[model samples]
Target chain A: EPEVTQTPSHQVTQMGQEVILRCVPISNHLYFYWYRQILGQKVEFLVSFYNNEISEKSEIFDDQFSVERPDGSNFTLKIRSTKLEDSAMYFCASSESISGRARDEQFFGPGTRLTVL
Target chain B: EDQVTQSPEALRLQEGESSSLNCSYTVSGLRGLFWYRQDPGKGPEFLFTLYSAGEEKEKERLKATLTKKESFLHITAPKPEDSATYLCAVQEADSWGKLQFGAGTQVVVTP
Candidate 1:
């Protein structure tokens, strides 16, 4: 089965540095999302992207965060000036459609573990 | 605001044993509920989607059921390989594609 794929399985960056996490969602998927899991914490929604624009974002997705569909197959999340608190596992997900009964299911990638020192 | 709570933070079972995991939610307008499984260092893997109170879906040893305020994931004759963290999430009422997820239950099945 086709699955979402993320690049740079693990990354280490210093505080105040920048990092960009990349994902290639399923080819036919339309809705894309970014979520993060702090060690020992629940998965938290960051942002959703569709039609080359942001559909919705949570408070966690603040000014330092940005997402881009740089190409037809690539969805990227960039965090500027990483902080110690930014250390976490960042996941990328995609869904075929978003409505009605089938809209709730989200297929997630293996995730990129970011470590900020 | 939407909140999802999963019961039994951790569980242990022997191979071939059967058990169920619970997920309860508090949301204004119910859109859909989802179930996923995660390995130690990986992202969540999609399992089932439940839209209505009576909806149920199954695959392999896993079966998922939904209700007005909660959802259950039943594992039948589980194997040691079935050990993982199971997560539950709810889609918000007005949001088009955002997901609110639960903390998840960690299961360890011994052979």
Candidate 2:
């Protein structure tokens, strides 16, 4: 079974530094997403990307956050300046289809644990 | 805005005990509801997907059922290895691919 994979399973960064979380979604998948879960909190949606463009984003995905599909297989999320609150487990997901109205299943990666100090 | 709520933040059961976890959602034009299990420091493993009311799916010791407003994940004769955090999420109405998730139900089974 093909699965989504992420790099830098764990990361530690300074409060004002920048960091990039990378993911290589299933090769044939067309839609990608980023979600975060704070300790003891719900998994929160950050953004969705399709056709190399952002489809939707949440309030938490503000000026400091950006996503890019630099190549065919890699999807990345960048944080311009890390904050204490930015520390969390970030998951990368992808679905093989892109029909908005139909039910599509997403495959998730193991996730990257980000720690900001 | 779409929202998902899960009941019983934590649950404990004996090796042969049976129990059910609930997930409630508030969203327009429901698309799909999903159930996943996550172990410590690992990604969520897909369990089931319910697309409409009266839909159900099962695997091993777990069964998932869905309605218009809520869903239930039933575990039968669960074992210690079944212990994990079970999360439920809903794909938003007209959403391209984003998913709104619940706080999850943590289940612990002891032998």
Task: Report iRMS values in order.
Answer: 1.1, 1.9
Best by lDDT: 1
DockQ class, candidate 1: high
Q: Write the per-residue lDDT of candidate 2 for residues B1-111, one digit (tens) a residue.
A: 438999989999999999999999999877789899999888888888888899989999999999889999999999999999999998866887778899899999999
TM-score of chain A of each: 0.97, 0.95
Residue B61, candidate 1: how far off, in angstroms? Answer: 1.4
Per-model DockQ against the true two-chain complex:
0.82, 0.67
lDDT of 1 by residue, B2-98 (tens): 4999998999999999999999999988778989999999989888888889999999999999989999999999999999999999997688688
How well is each residue in A47-90 modelled by candidate 1, as lDDT tens digits?
99999999999999999999999999999999999999999999
Per-prediction share of native contacts kept: 0.88, 0.71
**Number of clashes found in candidate 1:** 0
Best by DockQ: 1
